[model samples]
Target: MKLRFWGVRGSFAMCGREVLRYGGNTTSIELVAASGTRLLIDLGTGATELAKLLMQGEFGRGQGELPILLSHTHLDHIQGLPFFTPFFVKGNRIRIVGADPPGLSLQATLQNQLAPHYSPLNGLENLAAGVSIDTIVPGSTFTLGEFEVETALVPHGNMWTTAFRVTADGKVVTFLSDVEYPEPEAPLPEALHLARHADLLIHDAMHSDDDYQLRRGWGHSPARAAISVAEKAAVRRLALFHHSPDATDAMIDETVWRARAETKIELFAAAEGSYLEV
Candidate 1:
C-alpha cells in the first residue's frame, strides 16, 4: 500500500510567500493499494484539484469508482464537494462514506452544501459521478477492494469524527484527524488504544503548544499533543498533518524540529505531494 498527501492545511486555504513551503490546501489524502485500488480520504478544498488531476489521464475508466471516506461534515472537510469536476462527468460514480451525523440525513447534508446557496454550482440532480452516500457507524469494519478499513470515534469540534485504520498488503496505516485532546491534560486512552502499534500514523497537528491553550476544544491538537499521542501509540512513524493556515514555512520547520527533538519516533510534516510506501 502507498499513502500520499494531496492537501494538509487545516481550517482553510493559505497562500502567499509565507505559506509556500508547507502548502495551502486543506485536508485531503489518497491511499492506493497494490491492486491499483484507490481510496480517497476526506474531500476538502483540495478535492477540486484532485478531481482535475483524476480527469486528465486514463483514470476515469472502470475501477475508477471513487470511494470517499469523510471524517466529518466540517466546512474545511466538505467544502469542495460542489466543485469536484468528476460529478459533472457522465458514467462516473463516487461513493461517499460519512459518519451518521445527528439529526441530519446524509442526502440532506450533501444537498445543502451543493445546493444553490453555498456556491455557483447548484442542483446536482443531473450530474454524473453522482454521489452515493452511506453512513458508517463507529467500530464498523469494511472492505474496499483488497483492503480492510476500520473506523473509531474521536472528539472533534463539538461533534464526533472518525479515525481510520487501513490495512493493505500486510501494512497498517492510521489516520487520526481533527482530534481534540481534552484539558486539563486528560488521558488519551481511546485514541492511543485505537492507533496502537501502527506502521505510520498521520495526525492532526493544527496548533502549536503556545496556541493550544487559546484554542482548546477547537477540535484540533497541538504539535506536542500529537507527538504524545504518537509516542504512546507506539507507532513506527508519525506524519504531522492538518497544518494551521497561518503557520509559515519557518514556523512549521521549527515545529517539526521541536517535535523530533522531543520524541524518538521518526517525524515529518505532511506536505502536498508527499508519498510514503507502506
Candidate 2:
C-alpha cells in the first residue's frame, strides 16, 4: 500500500512561515492499495489540496468512487468535507465510514456539520455526489477492495475515537490519532492491538510534555507517550503525527529529535505531501 500525509496538524489549522515545513492542515491522509483502490482517512483542511489533485483524474469527470474513514467528527477532522471538490460532482460516489457518536448516528452527525447554520451547503443532500454514510461498530473488521480494515475504540478525553488497522499486500499500517494515553509509560490494549508489529504506525504526537501537563484531558498525546506506544507495540516504523497547532516547524523538529533518542525504531514526523510505501 502507498500512504501519503496531506495534513498532520491537530486541534486546528495554522499557517505562516513558521509552519511551512511541517504544514498547518489538520489530520487528513490518503492510502492507495495495489489495485488502485483509494481510501481517505479524515477530511481536515488538507483535503482541499487533495481535492485539487484528484480533480485531474477520474474524480474530475465525476466517475470516481472511494471510501473516507473518519476518526471522529471533530471540526479539524471534518472541516474539509464541504470544500472537497468531488462532492460537487454528480457521478462520483463517496462512502463515509465512522463510529456512531453517543446519541447521533454517523450520518446525522455529518449532516449537522453541513447544516445551514454551519455551512452554506445546507446539508448532505445538497452535495451533487452520491454520498453514503456507514456507522462502523468498534472492534469490527471490514474489507474495502483489497484492504482488510480493523477498527478499535480508544479513549479520547470524554469520547471514544476510532483507530484503524489496514492490511494489504502483506503489509500493515495502523492509524491512531486523537487518542490520549492514560499512562504515558503504558500502552492501551486497543492501541497496542492495532499497532502490534505493524509495518508503519502513525500515532498522535499532538503535544509536548509541558503542553500535555496543562491539557491532560484534551484528547491528545504527548510525543513521549506516542513513542511509548510504538515501543510497546513493536511497530517497524513510527511516524509522529497529529502535530499541535501551536507547534512551529522548529518545535516539531525538536520533538522528533527527542523522540528518536529514546527508541531504536525508525522515526520521523509526518509532513504534508510526504509519501511512504508499506
Candidate 3:
C-alpha cells in the first residue's frame, strides 16, 4: 500500500508564510493498494487538486471507479465535493461510504452541502450519474480490491465520527482524525483496535497539551496525546495528522521532536504532497 497526504490542516483552511511547509488545505488522504485500487479517505479542499491530477490521468478519463470513505460531514472535510472535477463528468462513478447522521441520511447530508442557496451546482443530481452511497455499520469489515478495511465509531465534534483501519500489501494502517479524548486520561478503545500493530497510524495531532487544556472537547488531541496513542497501540510508525489551522511548520517540527524525544516510534508530521510507501 502507498499512502499520501493531500491535506493536513484541521478545523479549517489557513494560509500564510508560516504554514507553507505543512500546507493550508483541510484533511484528505489517498491510499493506493498493491493492485492499483484507490481509496479516498476524505473529500477536503485538497481533493480539488487531486481531482485535477486524476483527470490528467486515467481517473479523469473516466476509466475507473472511485471509492470514498468519509469520516463525517465537517465543512472542512466535505467542502471540496462541490469543486471536484469528476462530478461534472458524465461517465464517472463515485461510491461513497458514510455513517448516517441524526435526522438526515448520509446522502442527504452531502446533498445538503450542495443545496440551492449554498452552491450553484445545486445538487449531486447535476453531477455524475453513476454515484452510489451507503452507510457503514460500526465494526464492519469489508474488502476493496486487495485491501481489507475495518470501520469503527469514535467521538468527535459533537458527533460520532468513523475511524478506519486498512490492511494491504501486508501492512496495517489506521486513520483516525478529528478524534477527541474526552476523558483526558485514556484513549479510545477503537483507536487501540485500529492502530494495534499498524505500520502507519494517521491520528489527529491538532492540539498540544496546553491547547487541550484550553479546548478540551474540540474533537482533537494534542501532539503528546497522539504520541501516547501510538505508543499504546504499538504502531510501527505514527503520522501526526489534522494539524491545527494555527500551527506553523516550526511548531509542528518542534512537536515532532517532542514526540520523538519521548518514544522510539517512527514519528513524522504529515505534510501535504508527502508520500509514504508501506
Best by lDDT: 2
Over 1-278, each residue of candidate 2 has an lDDT whose tens digit, in order, gives: 89999999998899999999989998899998888889999999999989998989999999999899999988999999999999999999999989998777888888999999999999999999958998899899999778889999998989989999999888999999999978877878989999999999999998889888999988889888888888889999999999988999999999999989888989999999766787
What's the true lDDT of residue 14 in model 1? 86
Winner of 1 and 2 under TM-score: 2
| Pairwise TM-score winner, candidates 2 and 3 | 2
Candidate 3 per-residue lDDT over residues 1-278, each given as its tens digit: 89888889997888899999889999888899878889888999888878887888766777757888888898898888888887777677788887887566988888888899999878878776356887888689988667788998888867878899988889888998888876644887877888898999998888876777888777788877678788898999998999888889999999888888988999999998766796
- Model 3, position 4, has a per-residue lDDT of 84
Best by TM-score: 2
Models 1 onward score TM values of 0.94, 0.98, 0.96
Candidate 3 lDDT score at position 90: 68
| Candidate 1 regions with alpha-carbon error over 4 angstroms | 59-63, 184-187
Least accurate 10 contiguous residues by lDDT in model 1: 56-65
Q: Which stretches of candidate 2 lie over 4 Å from their true place?
A: none
Clashes of each: 1, 0, 2
Stretches > 4 Å off in candidate 3: none
